[model samples]
Target: MSKTYDVIVVGARVAGSSLAYWLAREGYEVLLVDRGTFPSDTLSTNNLYSNSLGLLRGMGVLDALLNTNTPIYRRAHINFDGAVIDGLFPESDGITGCLCVRRKYLDQILFENAKAQPGVTAIEGFRVTALIQEDGIITCIEGKRKDGGDDIETYSARLVVGADGRLSKVREWAGSERKIAVPTDFASYAAYVTDFVQEGEMHVEFYKNQDKLAIVFPTSDDQFVVGVMYPLDDSAWMERFKSDPEEGIRRLIDEGFGHTSLADRFRKANFAETVKGMHGYDNDWFVGMGQGWALLGDALSFKDPAVGQGLHDALYGAHMLSEILSQYPASEWKRSWEPMGKVYQSAMEAKLMSRFWIGCQFTKNTPAPPEITAAYSLVGSDRQATETFLGMYNYVKEPEDLQKEIGRLLSGVNPQIPQK
Candidate 1:
């Protein structure tokens, strides 16, 4: 049990697996563990834009993702009520040219990629029970096979990571907390459907009505990810979803997306499986690392999936951690925890908080004033502004950062602007 490694990552999905793969590529030994078998599905929006795709390509997993035959999407078409705006993406061949792929395929792809690396070992169907602490510093992990075997298993590492999830056992064992918690402003549910009509090239579609927002994304396996985000200031819809998930979301789609062409698309289609929903959950974050442990993915932070940045934050955090871990030799990591933790906090905060705020704004789902809609109309008309608008969601540019530019653009068109 005393044999330590560069890191032992629990929860071998996107965050954990991507972390291990990135670390292994840097010549560090990693043990990646998860409680499920390959291709198992999880609750996710499962969309990643180009910047996140860059991380996957750097990790050498994009080639396999391409083989899944996920549709290639080059543009996004946003329907604000009746007005439509089309924006081209700023060139990315990553993500196999798709906006989303099912976690059934995407998580397994990242998992297998980590497992195949020379410095990485993997354990599936394993449940971690506890972290072994020595003098208040985590030094090892203890768990048993998810099967009925009674023998305890132990894994030692210089760093024990809690990529497990929002309900991470590692976070609990490490005594981490939701250092920052905020009430999320919206509830969301999404489902996959077959027979979704895609004509010619694929497009990421967004439909915004009075106070509701819904999306259609092209994922792998001949399915479309159709989802709706509802204002959570009122709890009625959340209660409805709790009462009956499928019916609640189905109703939302029938009402919200019905007027659009999406109605005809879903006319012949049926849900691929049960509806998945996220409701009444706080948008939260925990300390990035502790004495001898760290957190990643939803374990460390989760923004509103309304913004669809969950997958992006996972890979982005993991990549950031791997780069930080490389600053010191693997053997010295235990002693280097103090300085490492400092740098980790500073860097991740700068990167995470901007998007965190963006998610908050998006979840609020506040009505766009005429000026804002006018701005949207401008983006619709200009190619460059359209790219900037798209990049705001994808984190290429912070959404807030675009306010000045958008105001400048609007000043030229709207008479409400005073000539200064």
Candidate 2:
């Protein structure tokens, strides 16, 4: 006889742990499993927009997060072809943006919060190998323990969620076909630089040279996270930065840009930890998965960080799924998943995907068309337009709706639109 749970979630990272936390709090017999222990390391930019503030408050972890990390209120900075554009910070008071500690602290805090919840059994060092299903319904999972023991655990849940990341095992077991998949193209190198902290830290800085983009994010511990994104294929990246990561960063800043004052400061900053990796991938949505199981977060698909929407999308998805699972009957789980899927997918298409395409076009060194530049400039300058952009940037509004609204505004200024 095997133990059973009402819900079993794999991957105790951000998405998994958050889901388990909510599900367990809702009085469900939830089993949470992870390949690594809590407070583990993860690859991320180590920043969160203010939009997540509301969700954190609802989860009752907002105060903990704020106490644990720094608060960011500065907008992003874009450095293009020797020109700089300053945007407003994300949050405005309680409605403003925030940056909690980096992913290490953030994930650990979330894991601890989830572990403290009742009816939640968190098992670490368990590598889930496969799903155990009977008559087309998943009943249990099979895997090997860290101690070289073969363990078979049966968790007969009414609903199972695949919160595992890009290489998701739950998604695989659920038999969901990849509807849209793209290889990751952008790789990011981020690190904690100590002793160079600034108040109201700037969020992101985009350089005209695609080969170099620098971002400075504040951590809860008064440290700064400086990140650089570039093409992974360039072997010189390691050759250049490996000698002295700090110096390499400085050289990149000075050479990539036409020698800006901020770049000088970034080059001279004292960094704590220097790390690098690629940032790529487009909207990935799976299809044909059975009704009982659903995929959420990066498990379903992930877009590039160029838009800064991945985690927000993941958190939002978890919240949405929680609503559906708690409200709907077990039999109607599939139907419930579909509407949310469509809504989420539409969001990806409209916001992330569309923005990615537009960004790709503009980020190219070639001179942008007058119409394109004017449109972007219009949105960049107008307060309401900025609000719309900020809303989308923080995942507050659907991309499709924002697109329509922006189009309406743009049309008022420049008409002769096309209808097909």
Each model's lDDT: 0.80, 0.65
Tens-digit per-residue lDDT, 158-262, candidate 1: 889989887888988888867778776677788888887865578888888867788888888888888888877657777777888767766776787788876
TM-score of every prediction relative to native: 0.90, 0.82
Query: Model 2 TM-score?
Result: 0.82
- How well is each residue in 1-420 modelled by candidate 2, as lDDT tens digits? 267777788877777778888887667788888888767777676556777667767777767777774765557665544444466754532677656466777777777788889988888888888887766767677766687666555556666778888778888778888876555444456677776634344455555554566666667576776766655566676567666666666666677664766666665577676455543545565752354676777786666555555666667666666655677565565456566455545654444455444435432334545565455566666555656666656655545655665687766753355655
Superposed model 1: Cα runs more than 4 Å off: 1-3, 80-84, 92-97, 198-200, 232-244, 365-370, 413-420
